[model samples]
Target: MQVHNRRATLTGTVDSWLDRQQAAQEAHEAGAREVNNHLHLLHMALPAATAQ
Candidate 1:
């Protein structure tokens, strides 16, 4: 019974860690996408600025 309880505790900890890891990865990807979009807009504006 003690071993079973320990196993259950360990599983819960691991599951929590995995959930956090997934959340972090998703946030990082979203930030990267936003940065890329900003860069693309800047890139598009450069030609107009140079023409002026």
Candidate 2:
């Protein structure tokens, strides 16, 4: 019985850790997208500025 309980606890801990990891990955992807969008805008505007 004790071994069963221990296994259950370990499983829960691992599940929680996996959830956190997924959240972190989603946040990182969002940040990367924002940076990419900003870079794209900057690139688009550069040619106009240089022509003047």
Candidate 3:
């Protein structure tokens, strides 16, 4: 009984930890996408300059 209870607790904690990690990864990816989009727009808006 005690072993089962311990296993259940550990499983719950692991599930919660994985959930948080997934959320963090998703947020980081979203931020990176936004930053990339901004940089692309900036480059597009700049006039082409010839190097001497």
Candidate 4:
């Protein structure tokens, strides 16, 4: 994460959209006036489930 002029810039990947929103929320809570969320969502395939 990079912080300059009360703006927080987030970089890297997140598993879900919720995580991305949470990151920005945390930044705002930490006194960031502006947030530049450059987080990319990692699209990972889920494993197949076995039949019962």
lDDT of every model, 2 decimals: 0.30, 0.30, 0.32, 0.96
Q: For residues 1-52, could you state the per-residue lDDT of candidate 3 as single tens digits?
A: 0123222111122234445455445545544321111111112235689899
TM-score of 2: 0.31
Clashes of each: 0, 0, 0, 0
Error of 2 at 25 (Å): 0.4
Worst 10 residues of 3 by lDDT: 34-43
What TM value does model 4 have? 0.81
In model 2, how large is the Cα lDDT of residue 39?
11
lDDT of 1 by residue, 1-52 (tens): 0123222111122234445455445545544321111111112223445553
RMSD of each: 17.6, 17.6, 17.8, 3.6
Candidate 2: stretches off by over 4 Å: 1-15, 32-52
Native-to-model Cα distance after best TM-score fit, residue 24 in candidate 3, in Å: 0.4
Q: What TM-score fits each model?
A: 0.31, 0.31, 0.31, 0.81
Model 4, global lDDT: 0.96
Clashing pairs in 3: none
Best by TM-score: 4
Question: In candidate 1, which residue pairs clash?
Answer: none
Residues 21-41 of candidate 4: C-alpha lDDT, one tens digit per residue:
999999999999999999999
